[model samples]
Target: MEHSHTADWWKKSTVYQVYPKSFKDTTGSGEGDIRGLIEKLDYLQGLGIDIIWLQPVYVSPQNDNGYDVADYCEINPEYGTMADFDELAAEVRRRNMHLMLDIVVNHSSTEHRWFQEAKQSRNNPYRDYYIWKDPAPGGGVPNNWQSKFGGPAWQYDEATGQYFLTLFDKTQADLNWENPAVREEVVKLMTFWAEKGVSGFRLDVINLISKDQNFPDDDGSARPGDGRKFYTDGPRVHEYMKELNRRIFKPYNLVTVGEMSSTSLENCILYSNPEQNELSMTFNFHHLKVDYPNGQKWELMPYDFEQLKSLLSRWQTGMQEGCGWNALFFNNHDQPRALSRFTDDSEYRVESAKLLATTLHGLQGTPYVFQGEEIGLPNPKWNGIEEMRDVESHNIYRILQEQGKSPEEAFNIIRERSRDNSRTPMLWDSTPNAGFTSGTPWIKVDERYPEINVERQLHDPDSVYHHYKKLIGLRKKHQILIDGTFVRLDEAHPQVFAYSRVKGQEAVVVVSNFSKEQTVFQFADAFAEEWLEAGPAELLAGNTKQVPPLWKEMALSPFASYMWLIRRK
Candidate 1:
């Protein structure tokens, strides 16, 4: 525990994630632009954001909301031009904050010139750029692999007589990483952005880039998309990553965080360990999977709290012990708003928001705050099927119906799990369009915008926004918060999640009530009486200013959280 994460830039810095299109719009275009981000620099800096990890703003077909990139070096017209991006990067630098761009190298939009040419003929030079295979024996698709979006992973091209792999959407053709030329091209694209002043890269679905050379069927899997097992941590993943590090990232001294979907702890260590020099950090999605039951994301199921605790503890301990860094996040452009997913967003919105912040930020990782998360935004009412825009949501709905479920059942499930829940326009004020745009927003602003908007909360000290600012400041001021060892407490408590970050004699115990009912946290015999000196612990932060006597136990109001500094003699 003596070794610390104090000196590293990411270890102590708070990163703010911006989902470009829905974040803010200035051109009456109903979409957020790079210029809009430039205008909001002061607002982001005021929130103590040391870095901004912008979601993909690259030129794309809008098939997956900027994820399916058609051009890597240019900015999307919806987001503005390359010159506008330059201005935004300069503004971020002027504010003393770093800019991290989303790098979508796992696949490219079919509209990309390379993919277009690859579809022309089997002998085409661009054919090897994508994963293409001959038809099966019976004149069907190339393999039994299923797409993450829906149906088959293979898309047939009439012109070429071969099926190309599209792990995500049919329009997104997977790249053949086994081809050294393809790898070199990807590195070139990334280098182009780095030379443009980008500080970091958030590699999208990074683990999926390396696939099993021998295409095989996921026969035993009940679901179709079980194909992930083949590519989760493939044969050449580490080799490819190491090469990428040596060629692209290490040269710029840039930080990189790979978004890993189905990665193992052992491999994660190799991917992010500082000694390995592969990545600065890796985003493990296991914590976010607690809500998926039987491995089905569309199923309506309550989050398994115990499963969540165990998974998080494993990652926290495994990564730290393995000399690897962790990237911690609750909400993202791809997930539902955390306030509504984990807590009662209606009644205890403020308290639960603060509690979640206290719990996640106190851990040993580089915390990422999704856009609007600081203001405690909740998922908008799942208006109707027409409002849903994501291909994944629509695909899941159809799949559920094919599995013998009623249309209502499928709609309800997709309503709760759709990416559109988080894609709603940001609520900046009580204005008609939440001040995001003078024109109509791409997605309707949440109706509660009047109550939870930023304009009103910016001046309120007790707002969720202010609470986050305090948490970020605490991490910067208290070195222990960034370098302490994690110790879980009240493991069996259904309503309270508690832990302590200890470093030598200095420690901070974090306690949060996860339920709506009042609860009491008693000092376990070993925690207070046996280990610490007999004295009052200094309160560092809490939703409620009042701290009850902790001689034996302390009462916690519904959703209340506390961070106490305990120094043992």
Candidate 2:
């Protein structure tokens, strides 16, 4: 459980995720690239961001928008050359910030040289690098595995007369980690990035790295295609992660976070145990799964505040001491905006957005701020399914159509839940293409850029941008906010979510209104006595409140939030 490195550094760090394709396009080639990100380092630094987690810029066929890697060692020509990445890494370091690169080792593009070699013949040396098997007696797949993108997970390779494993698209073949050679190659490839000055790696679908060797088929009663339980969080996952840490990450003092899907709390603690010498942290999907119908594929579900609060609290408490850090996020390259998903964005967008930010960032974990989130960006109102670019969105649309859902219904779901929601061009200014590019953007920019762009908000003191700035600064300036213990207050209050972070004598109480209507609540007697009237600095809202409570209850405006520093009476 003991960490060789200091914990304080990570406790106070704020990571910013940049989806390269949508961040900024400098080449005017309709895509954002390394050069474009390099140009924006100053702007990110100005926003008080401490680390940059750049999503995949590696060579890919773009089947899954860069998740399918063709070459781990080379940069995609469309993104830029290796020289540009080196410069970007150096530039970020110059600002005294860190950079984390996406490591997609779970799978590779079917067109990759290794896959191509494997496809030629079963006897090829490269054949073992991927999982391949002959068809069943019935001339069907080896198992009832389902691809995350939809359809069967096993893709038939006619030339070899076998099927290769692909948990995602057919173009992305899952790697066989049982092969020692593959593990060695992954370590070497990771070392290549470490040597290039990448501070860390955000491992992609890392839990899927070690699959169930038995390759069991889904039961007859299983859903159309649900094999995740069999392949996810497999037996050798921890062993593989530990070996990776010992061989590559530990030696370099690198920060590594695993993008683990279907991982339970037990697995999270095991994989991220500081003493396990594995990952620095592992992301939790419990909150994200709230909208999934019985974890079934393509089911309409709604976000639940109580479910989210329980998930966050569990992670915060479960990983309190020796357990590795938790990576906190609401929106990423694959998620819709937090405002739209977590709040009632239709009427209380700004208040709910800021309240959500406060509620999340105030928790005990490493917070990740996705681009445009600071300005309270909501999911774009895409007119039709044709306007979306994400493959998952397209696949879901087709699935909905087959399930008898109307085109309008399909498009509506896509608009509200598509990964494309996060990929919309950055709203830097009110100019053409949201100031992301002069030429046409690779994807359509959100229409609300004129009011939501960074340029306008940066100058306005009351803007969400400035609110985030203060939040970041508060975390940095106050130890209680950064490295304190969390205690949930008024757990049964449906309209209120409150918690206090205490470090010895220093305490900061944070309370948020989760509903659209005002709520009245009183502080715990112990906290009320020591409460200091630190006039509301407006962390997210302009709402103010008087401190101390004995005979009266404090009221919070609709979707309002408050944080106050309290000392011992």
Over 4 Å off, model 2: 1-8, 220-225, 524-552
Return the lDDT, model 1, position 439.
91
By lDDT, the best candidate is: 1
**Model 1 regions lying over 4 Å from their true place:** 1-7, 221-225, 530-535
Q: What is the TM-score of each candidate against the true structure?
A: 0.96, 0.94
How many residue pairs of model 2 clash at the backbone? 0
> Which ten residues in a row are the worst by lDDT in model 1?
1-10
What is the per-residue lDDT of model 2 for residues 1-569, given as tens digits with 9 covering 90 to 100? 22233743666878999999999999788889899999989989988998899999888889988999888999999989999998998898888888999999899998799998998888999999999989998998999888888789998888789999999898999999999999999999999998888878999989998888888887745565588877789878889998998898878777778888878888888877787778888897878877777765356677667877777877887877656578888878888887888777778887777787888878877789998888898988888877888888888898898899998887877787888888888899988888899888888998888888989988988777877777887777777776788787766688888887878766667888888787788767765554434223223323234432322267777887767666554
Q: What do the candidate models score in CA lDDT, each in turn?
A: 0.85, 0.82
> Where does the lowest 10-residue lDDT sum fall in candidate 2?
534-543
